[model samples]
Target: MNLYSIAIQQLTRQHMATIEALVRQQPEFDRVEDLADRLRQAGVRAEARYVPAEKLFIAVYGDIAQVEAALETLCRLNRLNCVPGSSSWQLVHQDHSITQPAVLVIHL
Candidate 1:
C-alpha cells in the first residue's frame, strides 16, 4: 500500500478520527475564518475552533504532510512559526519573547 493508505490503516487501527493542532494565540474571528478557508483551498479538510478564553484548536483530516505544508505557508505569510510533530502541529508567534504553551496531541 502507498503512504496515504498506510496512514489511514494506522489511524483506523488506533480508532483515530482526526489529527489536531494547537495555535498558541487566540485569534480574532476573522482570522479563524481565514485559516479555515485557506486550509480548504489547499485541499485539506480542516476546521478551526476558538472558544472564548481558550487556545485555538485546529483539526485536520487527510494527509498530514499536505496539512503541514499548507499550515507552514499560512504561518509564513502571517509571520507565525509552524512547528510540526508526528500527529500534531503548533503555531507560534515569530517573536521569541512570547512563550509558546506546551502542546499535547491527544489521539482519539
Candidate 2:
C-alpha cells in the first residue's frame, strides 16, 4: 500500500478544532477515503490516520497525490487557509517507499 503523510500546523485552538471537526465529518473526507479504498480494493491496503499535537494535526494517507488533491480542494473550499506547496507547509516523499511522504502545513 502507498502511504502519504500530511501535517497541518495548529496555530490556535480554533484551527485545530476546525481540522478535528473536518476529520470527523465523513463527507469532508469522502474523496480521500474513497481514493484510499479504491487502492485497497486493488490490493493496496490503503489507510489514513490523524496525529494531533499542541500545534499540529498530521494526516497520514495512502496516496500522496490523492491527499495533495484533497488538501488542495479543502483550500479551494475555504476549509483550509494555505496551498499544498505553499511556504506554510513542506512536502517530502519517500524515495524507496510510500510509507513516508511528509506534508507539513504551518498555520497562519
Candidate 3:
C-alpha cells in the first residue's frame, strides 16, 4: 500500500472514535457530516469529522485527482467560501504545536 493508504488505514481504526466524539461536540460538524453523506452518495468514500484539539479532519480514499473535487463539493454544500489548508496526516503528536493541519485539513 502507498503512504496515503497506510495513513488512512491507521486512522480508520485508531482515530475514528476520537473523530466521532469531537464531531458530536460541534453543531457545525453536524452539517459537515450531512455534506459528507452526500459525497458518499456520489461515490466518494469521504469521511469528515473532528480530531482532538478542535481541528477538523477530512479523509478521502481513492483517486487522488478526485480529492479536491470532493473537497470543493463539500465547501459548496456547506457554503464555505474559502479553501481550507490541506494536510497529509490526521493527528499530530507535538507539544504546543499546531502542526497537524490546523486550517481544515484534507487528506487523501
* Ranking of predictions according to lDDT: 1, 3, 2
**Candidate 1: where is the Cα deviation over 4 Å?**
1-29, 50-55, 96-108
Residue pair clashes in candidate 3:
none
lDDT of 1 by residue, 2-98 (tens): 9999998998866543222233233444465666778788887877665546555666788767777788788888677777677876666788886
Pull out the clashing pairs in model 1.
none
Q: Candidate 2's residue-wise lDDT over 9-102, tens digit each?
A: 3346668887788676655345445434544444433454344453223334355655555555544543333334432344343243544324
| lDDT (Cα, tens digit) per residue for candidate 3, span 31-105 | 456656766876778788665575565566787556666656655654443344444422222333433222343
Where does the lowest 10-residue lDDT sum fall in candidate 1?
A: 17-26
All models: lDDT? 0.63, 0.44, 0.57
Residue range with the least summed lDDT across 10 consecutive positions in model 3: 89-98
| C-alpha lDDT of candidate 3 relative to the true structure | 0.57
lDDT at residue 54 of model 3 (Cα atoms): 52
Per-prediction TM-score? 0.53, 0.29, 0.46
Any runs in candidate 3 off by more than 4 Å, and if so which? 1-25, 74-78, 82-105
Clashes of each: 0, 0, 0
**Between the candidate structures 2 and 3, which one is better when assessed by lDDT?**
3
